[model samples]
Target chain A: MGGSTDSGSQNRLGRRLLTERVSGYWLQGAGYFAIVLFALIVLALLYQSLPLLSEYSLVQMLTSSNWDPAQNQFGFLPAIVGTVYVTALTMIMGTPIAILAAIYIAEYAEGRTKTLVSSFIDVLAAIPSVIFGLVALIVVVPFVGDYLAPAVGSSATGLGIFTVSLVMAIVVTPFMISLSVESLEALPDELRESSLGVGATKWETIRIVLLRAAGPGIFSAVLLGFGRVFGATIVPAMLIGGQTHLPSSPFATGQTLPTLIVNDFGELMSLPLTQSALIFVGLMLIVVVWLFNFSAMILRQRLQQRWQF
Target chain B: MDRYTEQRLFGLLARGAAALVVAVMVLVISVTIYRGGRVFLMDPTIVITPPGSRYMLEGDGGFLHAVLGSIFIVGPATIISAVLAVSTAIYLQSDYSSERFSDTVNMFLNVLWGTPPIVYGVFVLTVIIAIGARTSMFFGIVAIAIFQYPIMTRYTDEALRSAPDSVKEATYGLGATRFETALMTARAALPGVIAGIVMGFARGIGDAATVLFTAGRSTNMPAGPFDGATTLPVLIFDQAMSFNAEVRSHAYAASFILIIAVLGLILVSKLLAGRYARYAPGGRHS
Candidate 1:
């Protein structure tokens, strides 16, 4: 058997060597192609955006709050303010609900309830933002205007920072909940069981046991949700009436960075600097999200090192 | 407190809180229904119904052009992105070495992955429009494809890495070339690749920012890749913002379609991911 296998192995080795050479060549080629393609996209975008430096001073663009295109003066300061406010409000409103929902799903819910809830969250994750905005415009706006707006000291129109933020919160909640759920589920069952053995209630076990174990992961999810809300355009565009200035209050009118870019990019066609200024805002958003992702990666690595089943 | 009483309190609180989440789903459906369910049920004028005597379509309630534009943008982007991603993944998962190179590549991919679609849109549009890439559906397609490719590549790379080396060894022993082994032995991994692509496509289709700048608003039917087009998401944005009641109703109808389409893509991808995981080695959970 050993003698026969030697001959067979020799023939197989020959073919394997040939395949190895071909695969190695092709694989590297493919990887390089992807890299080049990605580089091209970045280069293209940067090339177009770089032209803005010739016309506008960075300070005037960033510091000036006025965005009146008719006067040819463009400032993104108010848009930035509105963007941060709405995103901050979304995080504040959505984070707790998401954490609680995640706790319920990971620790307490069982049987069909778990399946149903998980699938529901999955479906929610899939819904388009345009749809979210449309529904919010017709239904949420009217309801808020009729019921909550008066109480919140706003007019009966559905347009306001609070409305946009609320919709954004809803849009991002599923992402937070899903990530938190998965991280919580990844924790050791023994941890929960041991905590329970110590006579802790389920709620206490969740607070002390699950939260501690999944804290980093939950935080990462919230950061991701922040990015999602920050980049979202349609939700603020339609729901908040796409005001280019900062809202007077949380319940007042507002616009976000992406919405403003979308709303005004067309009008600033002749002013390449204004458009590039918008691109710079987008770049800042990318930078913020990149930082979040970097930290999320670091947190994930730490969690992997610290946790085990 | 007794065990039974304690269990009851926790369960009650859990159920009560969970009910609120259920309320959100209900709110989504009910609000959609309240706004446009009547039109769908009563008039049943989906956008694609044949045209009438005039140039006006018979059941022109939905933004059919936008829907078509979405499909148009998503379809090619999905194909190209999937191919790029899977190919890159295969390359990364190969016996290639050097830990530093791997880490560098991962850092680039992750940062690119985290970059939002809107930012990509703004950046890409500025680049393309400045270079005089005509404002058309093609630019939207390309912009979305560029944005989606990195994500697909990462997920596909992970899936390929998870593919059992033993299987590849077995294929190699059978005298299969690397490409053959990748194509044949790694064929089992295609489902996850498809899932990643579909997930990306779902995101691309729903995206509003990238297209808003690149794909200018055009109410007319798209002539070709270069033809200016308004996607469903953009049209929904337009109609939602419009003062016209008829257009607003049309926007609701379009939103209903987009919602259903996105949900369908997600569900199908989930199903595919499950099926892929079953036969796959180590079972990719992503």
Candidate 2:
């Protein structure tokens, strides 16, 4: 505002224009950095993982449960199932409470209670996943092994699919709750007003009107939470008990793909085939998360377009 | 089975769920603080003291190395990311770009944001292997910067998008260029930008998986950015997994410091964004 206007000469104005043009181009480059980084991640994983694909087909890697690194057995069926099992459990336990809490915040909570619960969720989000892992390792594992598992009449050490998913349920609830609160709050007040005016009760209006309107946003929130739990590493790594075999039950130990990479990549980096396999594991994770993220983004955009007045 | 009773029951359930979440969070924080506080209660200066030989085995020293290491790695990484993220957010505005372009790019950024931190670590480690370098603090910085970049950019972009169009129009009316307009808009969105930056710093400092392989662990103090370093989160992972009872307590103490730093940042972020919302256009005067 000051420089070019304050200057007296045509030369200074020309220089200012040049600088502005250059800065524009610079900002454009900055804008493209995300695209570039995304492409680089995909390309890097693809390049590293091409070899394993050549050696064994995708279905084979996905279907076979054997994972003997020493014997060149690189099946991922168990890990893939384990990942799904953990994610399903996380969602089942987390989504109900998250949606209910979100509904409470949007429909029922007074000012102070809403503010307190939202801040609590914010605090939970700020706590790192590794901290969750550490706490689960110390508290949940022993509780399951020493008490809960015994109560269920199962001999379990507690480091299993169930324990990891339980901890993951807690870890991912903040994300789902925050996003869900946004979706529910974004609905027009008239939507609620009309429902109540038509003689619908509060719960009935929320169930029949608001929740239906906010369905896309809530579903997308669930999808993003799925991605979060799907890609979870620390909790699974610390508490999965490092079992390579397929688990016989929820109480049995197993690893997710991310945990598989984390637990094995350090020692196996020197083995070319093993390194490729681990990178392939990473590729699978990226692919799955990308799919979830893509659909969630679409759902989010739909919700935005619908609500935009 | 009655309608009113059903409504009351659900309302109670929802309240219970909300209270349950709050209680779990309180319990986790209190347990860590209490357990971690015991060690620090015995030796209050351990936060500042460096570790010694057999630190993991005997818990002979403090976690100063990891504390310093986290600062050194995540501090500069966050600076780099803040610059890039702010500029990227500026460029994505309607003034400087098309709506379609912004939307598409935002989708990409969203996906990148959702990409796991471990993926970023693997990406950086792959780059390191391709370039023939060992794991070090420098690579750790690169990994975390990439991980934080999308997150910060998304927050800043949202902030800038919510900035009043009147401010931009005023700048243009005054003969300011697009870049100058963006600079002014950024100033108006300072609260959200600062909050995003603080959140990024907390994440980068707290993530262990991103730097697990990229930053090799070392007991001695990191000599330089290229040297191996163990961040507080990574140190906690190691100590928590250590078979020794003393080392496990060290995990608690280290987490105590890490939790305090992270939760304090979260609070600062919330307070800044909430208290300063009126600074923008159409809001109360300062």
Candidate 3:
């Protein structure tokens, strides 16, 4: 460190350094801000949810499987089940198409075709989920009921696990495609060249080498997409056919945590227990999202470490 | 002959699939436009005339107001978010390291980037409403900023990290201070950062759930931070659920407008990214 001789100069230098250290304190304050914001959110949710938890113990809330807000029987098992069911279904519905689209865009398609497809994906990403809900409610539900349901063995009820998953797939597909394309783009040119040089077909090289190398990244994308579909409120709110108790059938009406909060909170504002019950649901959702994030980070670390090729 | 046959078959399959994806996307746009355009075109009742005239009357101003409200809400939020995000990124990158601090920052940003916006909306709404900041556009803007910051942070980090290390070292080796190098050397490479900020704006505008809770549902133009106002998403939500047929048409129109603005931003970013990738060999594209 540079040294100063005069005591006054030393004090001036010390103050200057102190000021510099404190400069843009807001930047360092951001971590504190994030933690506080998250804590406040959790606490507020707990306050809101206290009513329902007090009215019914946590055990009953977990085991009852019935959601009768009016009757004061607030079992969330069905909603939890439904939320997970739709998320998994959406992943199943969307992943293959996303992977294929990413492969086509990043690996195979060239020129105007690539640009056009890429633009389409971007547009899809830009379109809001509520718009998707409107479209699904108006067009998709009818189409599903009139054609898809009869073709299969189920009838379209306008709200069901299937419709929710379908809408969720549309929302999630672009995310998955975008992420996979990123990882695909990250692959070095030489890896592709060497695979080609070894007399391997393009499909073989993509499946065996590219896909394997991109595994962790692709997994991260899927998990990210899952996080999105899990938290989405409008689609499930608008289209999920059954709204009363937990949905027993795929076609049965159901409520996820967000919809439950919106639905019950409006009427139960005066009831602390009711409000707290819903907040408890929100807390559950935060936990689910946190879990998804933790796994995705792990997967991302693995991908960054393993995929130097 | 074999190679030609192989090319022909694979080429046909590829062309077919490409055509399908294109067709599906076009169908989505065309449908949205058709639904949206009905507000301007087919509805004779929607035509506005002078109040005293016998000719006609104006369509309800719901869609118009909604569009304006969205702009008002997202615009300031985007600016504030961009400043904070870029500053933070620059501060971090000015002392580039594979250290714990940088990693912590990256993880926080990544989680923010990946967490659903709906969650943020609910979270912010919980705080704002709890603190009696409800019914204020100020809270709404803050909510949007929260959502936008994560994206900007990631983008700025990537952009600065990708800025040629040689230029930075050259500046530093000449005895230039860190701030000077960042401002003179790094700030010049801010086009990519700016593009990222625009992209964040696009996301903020398209967001419905977040703004819905933070920004209260008011029909009037926002008077100030304290004034209650409804944004495009909230207006659309109200219309979509409304029993009125006329309002439904307006909702469609508003959705179309929001979608166009968002898609436009994304396309611009893509173009900027592609151009940067071609020209700036050292910079990474989002």
Residue lDDT tens for model 3, A1-309:
345447777797677556545644644565334444555666776776665565667887787787776667778887888787888889887887778778878888889978778867866776777777776767778777777767777755556878888878877787788888888888888888999899877776777788878888788888888888888877787777547566666666777766776566465445545655766776777777777788777777877688656
DockQ of each: 0.48, 0.78, 0.32
For candidate 2, give the lDDT. 0.87
lDDT per residue as tens, model 2, B95-212? 8889999988998998988888889988998898889898999999999999999989998998887777888999999988888888889878878788889988988888988999
Candidate that scores best on DockQ: 2
TM-score (all chains, Cα) for each model = 0.87, 0.95, 0.86
The CAPRI class of candidate 3 is acceptable
- Clash count per candidate: 0, 0, 16
- Model 3 stretches with alpha carbons more than 4 Å out: A1-24, A31-36, A43-55, A300-309, B1-20, B42-61, B94-98, B267-286
Candidate 2 vs candidate 3, lDDT winner: 2
| Candidate 3: residue B16 lDDT (0-100) | 55
Per-residue alpha-carbon lDDT of model 3 for B202-269, expressed as tens digits?
A: 87887777776667766655677777766777766767776667666766766777677777787677
TM-score pick, better of 1 and 3: 1
Model 1 lDDT tens row, B1-286: 9766876776676666667877977888667756666555655555774222222223234455776788888788888777777777776654563666566667777667667778777766766665777688888887788778887888677666666677788877986666777875456676667677887888788878778877766776778998888787887777777666666676666676777678788888888877776666566565
Weakest 10 consecutive residues of candidate 1 chain B by summed lDDT: B50-59
| lDDT preference between candidates 1 and 3, better one | 1
In model 1, the fraction of reference contacts reproduced equals: 0.58
The digit string of per-residue lDDT tens for model 1 on A3-86 reads: 889999988888878877876776677677655654765665556556665667877877888888667576878888898899
